[model samples]
Target: MVEPRPDQKKGLKERCPELLEIARLVSWCMNRDYLIRSCLDHINRRLGMRARCVLKEKEQLKLHCWLGEYECRMEQMPICKESIVWKVVEEGIPVNLTETHQCEGYSHTLGEKVKIKAIVPLWYADQVTQEEKRVGALIVDSGKMGMPVSDEDFEYLKVVGELIGAAIGKAELTEQFIDSYKRKEIMVRETAHAFRNRIAAIGGFSRRIAELARDKDLANEAKMIYHEVQLLESHLEQFEKYL
Candidate 1:
């Protein structure tokens, strides 16, 4: 494993903008798929590497985003203890490898041999357990047989992983919140509809009482009730527009 050193200030300066842009994405991006795709694009484009993202679902590692050299048809694969993905994902460690084919379950992740690969995991807290857990992994294939991936690239990838994990996690949570809110809005609309019907019924009865009442005071009271019902109905209609 190679450690990331910030020895070159120029390189760090150049990457600062990318990191800031990714941070903005993390803060505001609400769509899970779009956030992952956009983050992978930044990593691949800036580093000139083929990258892919894998997410954990139902105890299986599934491919979520691919920015590879060729088309991808492969899908989900079981998580083995020995696979590089598990090393990074379950253990919360990043690994830079020279021969990815030697790693167990490499074929399931990417169908071809990668000259060099950097794998980093995305971690999140479990909603029920409240324990820290990994959500996914980000893999970047860089360099050729002769050149090897740069140390600077590895450092940049490490930084990218730290933020990307949170961005993806937040996006997922945002989606869940939106779905829950929509369901509540539907319930509100239904309840409001029922209340509006009751108001209309009361208004009709009040109007009838006013028409039949012989006493002026009784008729005036009925008309007041009818007028109040009309105002309430109007207010309910305006409130429903928000939901």
Candidate 2:
């Protein structure tokens, strides 16, 4: 392994706080998009390089999030023959470079220089399957001078990217569970309501029977039904308070 320059080592040291905060975000932040955006902003601001990530959705690679003036010009990156994003995600390796050059997806013009930087693969730690899944690519934007982002920064980005991907996947799963639970809860409540309505009908009919019936046996049965229904309704009302 090549030794990082003193400046590079210092850069990594300074990024410790950012890394910790990113980890916190991953664990606790409910808003997945905000977490991703915050992480990218931290990378760009601390490292002086722009960053974005694109994950594969079906057959197409779509931009997930980006932070750079150049990125604003394009809605999404092209995944054609020249796309560097496609290669890195497919191969699972960083296009280690000492100098920046124009490449697809990561390409952008600044003054007269075309700056396209290296990309590192992002992996998500699947909670359900307990597997590390290669999910996306971290795209870097070379600075105005067209200098390549250091390998150390690439490593840092990969670490944070992994967290981001996992958090996003987890958030999606949580949302799905919430929606499913809500649907089931509604069904149960509706069923309870219908059951209560039927009980109320029985109570009403029993009360009328008790009032009108002359036969002692029938009147007694009607009164018992009405009293039992009232007791059942009291229990149901208590349960419904929780709902």
Candidate 3:
């Protein structure tokens, strides 16, 4: 890789520290244990405004992570799922707002505090099957402690939101994997004694049958079963790696 000139490096750090910080934070999200609140704090500091993460909890939007001046008392907001910002999340797109009047589903009271903004949905694939799924949305509101949000803030928020979404997806995957492992641990412990012996015996014979079975279909079925077990083992290895 070519090294940047001293002048170029200094210029980048001075003029684009916010973008650099965003990149660093996203890289941190590769490890699922990274807290969403901490991330919001980082973004808030970068943008010099409030940032929050709203998750699609059942039929309502719930504030999962938040940072900044105003107290977001509406923890469980019952806005329509199809509302402007929520629709962007549900559709896995970014919603940029240049003015408060253009917002949908937000309480009128919040209009004074919220300014130009961008809401980006963090979409991810099901870790096991890689199915498209919408997990959460990141909310970035512009303006200083007192100033109203502006178009420039909206543009910055929109760009930042896109990069942040990728990190959110990675974090969500880690979270889901951790949850799955915990659940699997409980189930495995409950039945380990009973299943271990049976699996060992079957595995031994299945290996032999897999090599000698005359029926191609039966051999393939045995192979598939072994592959499933291998997948489980791989997950266990990942749990250990993380632990």
Q: Pick by lDDT: which candidate is best?
A: 1
| TM-score computed on alpha carbons, candidate 2 | 0.77
Name the regions of candidate 3 deviating beyond 4 angstroms: 1-17, 28-34, 71-83, 104-115, 127-130, 143-156, 179-192, 195-243
All candidates' TM-scores?
Answer: 0.73, 0.77, 0.54
Model 1 residue runs over 4 Å out of place are: 1-14, 24-31, 70-82, 99-108, 113-116, 124-133, 143-151, 214-217
Model 3, span 1-243: residue lDDT tens: 112234322222353666667677777657532556666766565556677777766767766666776654645454444456567777787766665677645543243446466777766666678787776677776433433434455555555555555666777677878999999877766565456556666667777777888999999988877776666656555655544
Candidates, ranked, lDDT: 1, 2, 3
lDDT for each candidate structure: 0.74, 0.72, 0.62
Indicate the residue-level lDDT of 236 in model 2. 92
Residue-wise C-alpha lDDT for candidate 1, range 65-157, written one tens digit per residue: 777455445455554445667667878988877654556454434445453677888887756577776888888874343234566777888
lDDT of model 1, residue 222 = 100
TM-score-based ranking, best first?
A: 2, 1, 3
lDDT of 1 at 139: 85
Cα RMSD, each candidate:
5.1, 4.9, 12.2
Weakest lDDT window of 10 consecutive positions for candidate 1:
1-10
